[model samples]
Target: MPLARSLRLARLHPPQVLALGFIVIIAIGAFLLNLPIAFHGARDLPFLDALFMSTSATCVTGLSVISPGEDFTLFGQLVILTLVQLGGLGFMTMATLVALVAKRRITFKERLILQEAMNHGSVEGIVRLIRRVLLYSLVIEAVGALLLSVRFLLEMPADQAIYFGLFHSISIFNNAGFDLFGMFPGRPGSLIGYVDDPFVNVVTMVLIFLGGIGFIVIDDLLHFRERRKLTLHSKVVLSVSLFLIVFGGLVILVFEYTNPLTLQKLSFPEKMLSSLFQSVSMRSAGVTTLDVGGMRQATQFFSILMMFIGAAPGSSGGGIKVTTFAILVGAVIAMLRGKEDIVLFKRRLARDRVNKAITFTLFSFFFIILGAMILSVTESYDFLGILFEATSAYATAGLSTGLTPQLTGFGKALLMAMMFVGRLGPVTLAFALTPKHEKELVRYPEGKITIG
Candidate 1:
């Protein structure tokens, strides 16, 4: 009753309310994970760091101030990775799917929340679709784990290798990017031990790419099963994802071929594999087998672009999303062509959708900028590096420029705030912050302003 009263008072819009619930739940999980009970050994982490880790995990962003490998025991690491799974799969999404599978009915309110969670259209077939998502996820991750374990078994004992393979398979497949090698000198050395292992790199990269491609796209592909006709959404996502993987991989391959900093010294096969890994990592995968900080400025800049773009909508990876990018590009083309309507694949675009896309893109860009500016003022690090980390956090991309660990207490707080906002998103956070609007009475005639 009290909760109901608060919701009524807050005029809680579904999205904002859902976001609040999510963040609060993640915070609680963070607290629990930091508790001594969740650890295999001593719990020595500061409260802020724990909360930050929790938020990062729950957001499915891999950014961390302390290495998970060194800072926490296996239990603690599992907790963080679990949170990542929850974050990516979405708390409400899992719940709704479970309810449906159990022959329980979802409330109308729950459907609305699920709609936003999956970014699917309306609330139609949501229950069935949610079940499909879960089933598909399990099947794909299982196969990925099987492939990944074979590689890991070659490097470690049976039990340990199997567990490691499972953990990493789930993590990469969720696009979580958290690793058990936090003790690995904060570089790619942890994974470097396996750099020459084709099976390991390939499996990990495949999981990361597939995981980042958004479940919505996955659903469409599964539904169509390579059908001659693909939905516009799936087509755009697949086309962009393919282009990014290939183009980004080729660029990294060419640039790092002999650079010594990245892949020049590696064997031809390893170099090719590393390039592929880095390219797949760009969609906010956060895994790395090469020293990102040692790469040339151009590579770093390109990486930033990839992170900014992030993954596809309704997927684990975070960013403005591939669909959003496609929409923005389509808008630009329409404007250039002097067409009043922005059309894609012969389908008319919706105004509210276009507005939402533009707003999301603008708000995301500004939010990152705001975070970077605040970070620049608060931290003494090189401005560009800090900015890169800030965007990485804001996009939930987790591809830091090696400045994450060195951030001051205040800087951590700033980043914590950014991570929270990034995870919740600007529009949702804005909705939470702003007072609810009442139905308006009068409509005012608008005068068109002269524009460029």
Candidate 2:
């Protein structure tokens, strides 16, 4: 009977399992954070605030209601950091570690879950991929921490500098964007104090880029010598990412060049640095060296577009995904050019893939609009601010216009829902909520549709 029950439990849908896993993690994190040890002083941390922070961390959305460094002690900070690491690397990937330690073969059901978790196309070599992913993440984070710690050593004590180094490195690489800079005087928030510091800016941008670029691309690049070529997916992700970064940076520079509150006071080099950082960070890093709230409306709107697009699939970041956006663009081009099939890199795109992309993009838009509409009514913020916050939460981009900290309870709850959906993805959630159905046995006749 116990064996049958275990088997039944294992047979649960992968999406449902993944979604529940995240919820469980968030609940535990929230509980831990609500403890007295988690805070610094006598002020009690509200359960709603604890849950908000936990959801943000576990989802890696970084929409904090309280300052981590100023409000929480080392214990709470560690909990948040652990949540970020787990969230950044999907919880299933972390489970692979336990399996490895136990010397147990990964069950087929678990492999399916890992496929869903990692956003991989198949179950083949899923365990191998997890191993490489873990190794790659640790090595990259180690180097990032080393470099950051060395730099920080020049500014603070050895012990604190080392901790800061490790913390920021993991946060940036995971695209979690939770920073400990708030405790310091004159630091303001985020990476704003490092606006003109080239070393800090460059290191951070590099980490953010790697974190968002997707692990498949990294694996392909590392194995290029053996494969002798990049996969079409890698090519598309790289090309689209490069284009977005450059385009975003240039647009930001042009729009904010003379804005007195942001880039105007900086020298040309400093301005360029800030612009590039914003471009990189907008994809989901959330750590900013510029005044995000002070940017022009045009700049903020443009940023909203970028945040909505978010990072590539299977990466730490979230959004509609680069491939989805790329396919949509391809579809439009093919329609305009009168091509029967969408083609990318001389390869014909599958019809199902195109349909899925359209469906996903539309669903994303619907949710973002829905969330924004609710926030607009519940909060006192302007339309743009509400929309930006909504999109940021849904994209898991974590960029904000200084509106997050002031949200009402309903607003915070709404954003948490957005973050959860953003992380698990709309389609996955749909599947989790939907009951299993048999394949359609009846085929409907085709009917002509009205013209656009």
Candidate 3:
């Protein structure tokens, strides 16, 4: 039956299936959520709001107009969580898990779909990689939940503590950023209320870091001793990830250290913790320890850059991806040095990979700019806030400068489109939209063009 299903699905390309799967899931989620049983007493969720939240959650982007904890009943929250899990680990992955559990073979066409969904290089070992992905996700989220639950017991009842711990662990580990803290009246919500809590801060940051690094990197690290070395991909991801976190934290610390609305009230240690947390969160985790709205405009602009770079490939988090940014930087350096190839860690990158990175980044930039421009006209927010919201959606970074909730219906729709594209990736969406072409049979003569 699974093979037959794959055969029927052959009408659509793998990328199309991957893209369409999200839309179908989002539609079902929105319908379920708009039902009366999904919300708190007598509250009606408009279809648009439901659709927006559904898109956000399904994309693993946490730009919510409605507070998940306050507006959503247990049923609704559960629906959102389900969407996050499906979105965080691509639906194809969940399908693969189902096949594995059912003892059904994953047909080659299905493996091809999984390969595209997971951004894997090939169909070989795709099943094994997915198995490892599921294992790592479960183990990591469990440990994070355990730690958080223990900490929550210090402040809340056992039942509530456990639930909050579980929900937050899954959310943060998936980089979805939804939080139940909003249920506490007058609380600033997110991780802001726990700003000085080192345990929560560290655990949340760890989850975000792990989730942001691609599953391939996690698998590589797990077998490092046996392998005796890391792959070039893993090395680039790790080094770039470390540098971004450290550099972004320092920049935030310096910029906001004396701002009265932000870090001024915090002690040195607390400030450092807040800065570090924001740095990690900017890589698509979205939960913040500081008041993102209160930070200096300069800091916010820098944050846009961080969010734009976002997490590594094959990770739950989004953006153009760290590797894409790295490739562009490497390409620039190579051009400056008059080198023929882009080299890193004693390995040369393929020209096609570099070209794809460039094209991907440009598409992302154009998409965000277009979204921001339309938002500026449709909403009353300032340019910076508009840009931040647009970038946040496009990168699925979920960090907002207080502009999300005020967005008009049209603005929400635009952002939903952005989140959808951002999560699937512009390149993937393009492939899904256009029919595949065969390899070029005719060679064209090279035309001389002026260099930049």
Worst 10 residues of 1 by lDDT: 1-10
Model 2: worst 10 consecutive residues (lDDT sum): 1-10
Tens-digit lDDT track of model 3 for 56-158: 9999999999899989989999999999999999888998888889899888878888899888898999999999999999999999999999999999999
Off by over 4 Å in 3: 1-7
lDDT of 2 by residue, 1-452 (tens): 22222543767788888888899899999999999999887789999999999999999888899999899999999999999999999888887887787687788888888899989999999999999999999999999999999999999999999999999999999898999988986677998988989999999999999999989889989999999999999999999999999999999999999999999999999999899899999979989998889999999999999998999988989889999999999999998999889999999999999999999999999999989998899999999989999999999988889999999999999999999999999999998888695799999999998989
lDDT of 1 by residue, 1-452 (tens): 23323543665677776677677767787788778755544546787888878888888778888778777777788788778878888887766656656677676767777787787877888877888788888888888878877776776688877777777777788777777765545445336566677877878877877788888777777768567578888888888888888999999998778787778778887888889888888768777888778887788878877888888878888888888888888899999999988888788888887999999999888888888888898888877788788878877877777898888888888887877777777777787687776788989998898888
Model 2 scores a TM of 0.98
**lDDT against true structure, model 1:** 0.78
Clashes of 3: 0
- Model 3 has an lDDT value of 0.92
